[model samples]
Target: MNTIVQASPVTEKSRQLVTVATPENAQYLTFLLGGEMFAVGILHVKEIIEFGNLTEIPMMPAFIRGVINLRGAVVPVIDLAARFAGEPSQPGKRTCIVIVEVQDGDLSHDVGIMVDAVSEVLEIPANEIEPPPSFGARIRADFIQGMGKVAGRFVILLNIHRVLSVDEIATLAGVATPGEGVAHRSGS
Candidate 1:
């Protein structure tokens, strides 16, 4: 969680420079959350695992559902719904955790994000991607990569790095960790 990310790296396959209708393609892994379709760059995805037990840490932010031990490493699991300041998500039959590697500083940390269900990997043309709107989005504008047009519909492209920023989340961890001298901030 102490990792630092300068920026999200684009995969070699998606390294093509995109301009207006240039045919340059990028792949995104699509998923459902709160009845809306959202996607993250495929390059960031590690693997998908079934939702299971998580060790809840006390006094952390509500969005931080808990931590899970993945092959001896302590990986934190985040509720994307709550992270967006929405209601907590209830894991359903199709619910699962998507393991993603987030670059922080020079190191990469594995983090888990809960999604209602994973849809599919889609190759979208760069021309079909529109810059994030300045307002009226359910989540923070900084969290959006773009709005992608697929099959005449719009899918929110998530800027996972921004959404899972280690520095920001680390602050929350500090607030919860004993001896940090920061009281937990809560609001109804």
Candidate 2:
């Protein structure tokens, strides 16, 4: 399957600076993955779609469940569970895909992330957000953006950009397309 991302024009709405939205009023789209609460900044979110049949491609990474033709664009669907853990995500009644926009240089691409279910959008205050724990996280430390405290509970704020990095994933997946210039780490 061709996974090259085509660039689209940036919109005026997206031109608003992220700094304009402080944590005090920042919104997050919370979702469940492996029964754990996780969130992504709403600004990075494009939309959420119902779970649908996907076209599977052979020899791809396990985390890469398949691709879905979103409109006319071929968007790759990622199994979030498989990416973080080592197993594929099981489809549940509330299963769905969250379309997230990831930046590649000056261009943007929309990628689908499979999740157990979407909870709600919440406003997490600055005081309630804390730095990632030094350890004890199920996922890699770099994946976490922060720990948001809500209703006396902690929600994992994901660094979506890092998680959905096309070039990084493509390089690490051993399918780096020429001219993408996705640098691979030495001696993993």
Candidate 3:
């Protein structure tokens, strides 16, 4: 799959302002996955929800944990670790779901992503961000826009739209009716 990375545009005027306001910076919602910290652009995040009951969908990819009712809308939730790193999620108190809006073609859809924990929102200066490595990244580099340095550690900045745009997950509800999978669970 071709993952599109949006680069922060730089202009001469913006460069001059960077000395003070740092206009190249983009706000990111930092979160935890496994033991590492990762972030997604703040523009994509809609809300953060404490882990709750998820109605499972049968015959779907294992990465798809299930769906959650968000104010009457059934949003499919995907386990980030399993979806990217191919491992099962072991939930803890810190686990939570981040609701985000993604665009598929011309349609905008809201999807929920499960993360180990919700951290803080941070503004990463463009200069502190480096393009994703061609190799050595644990997960597919396509899912990453770049790596941002925060508190001296690298934070994987994910391209949320691309990460959850898999064809199967997009068509799950349309193909299978609700409550088709394993029984609903009380928490993550």
Query: What RMSD, rounded to one decimal, does every model reach?
Result: 7.5, 6.2, 10.7
Total backbone clashes of candidate 1, pairs 3 or more residues apart or in separate chains? 5
- Using lDDT as the measure, the top candidate is 2
lDDT of each: 0.81, 0.82, 0.76
Ranking by TM-score: 2, 1, 3
- What are the clash counts of all predictions, listed in order? 5, 0, 1
Q: Which ten residues in a row have the lowest lDDT in candidate 1?
A: 13-22
**Global local distance difference test of model 3:** 0.76
Q: Which residue runs of candidate 3 sit more than 4 Å off their true CA positions?
A: 1-23, 166-188
TM-score of each: 0.80, 0.82, 0.77
Q: After superposition, how far is residue 123 of candidate 3 from its true place, in Å?
A: 0.5
User: What residue pairs clash in candidate 1, if any at all?
Assistant: 3-104, 4-104, 4-105, 5-104, 5-105
- What tens-digit string does per-residue lDDT give for candidate 1 at 109-164? 89999999988878898989999999999999999999999999999999999999
lDDT of 2 by residue, 47-150 (tens): 77778768886667799988887767888899999999979988988998888888888888889999999888788888889999879999988899999999
Give the TM-score (vs. native) of candidate 3. Answer: 0.77
- Full ranking by lDDT: 2, 1, 3
Top TM-score hit: 2
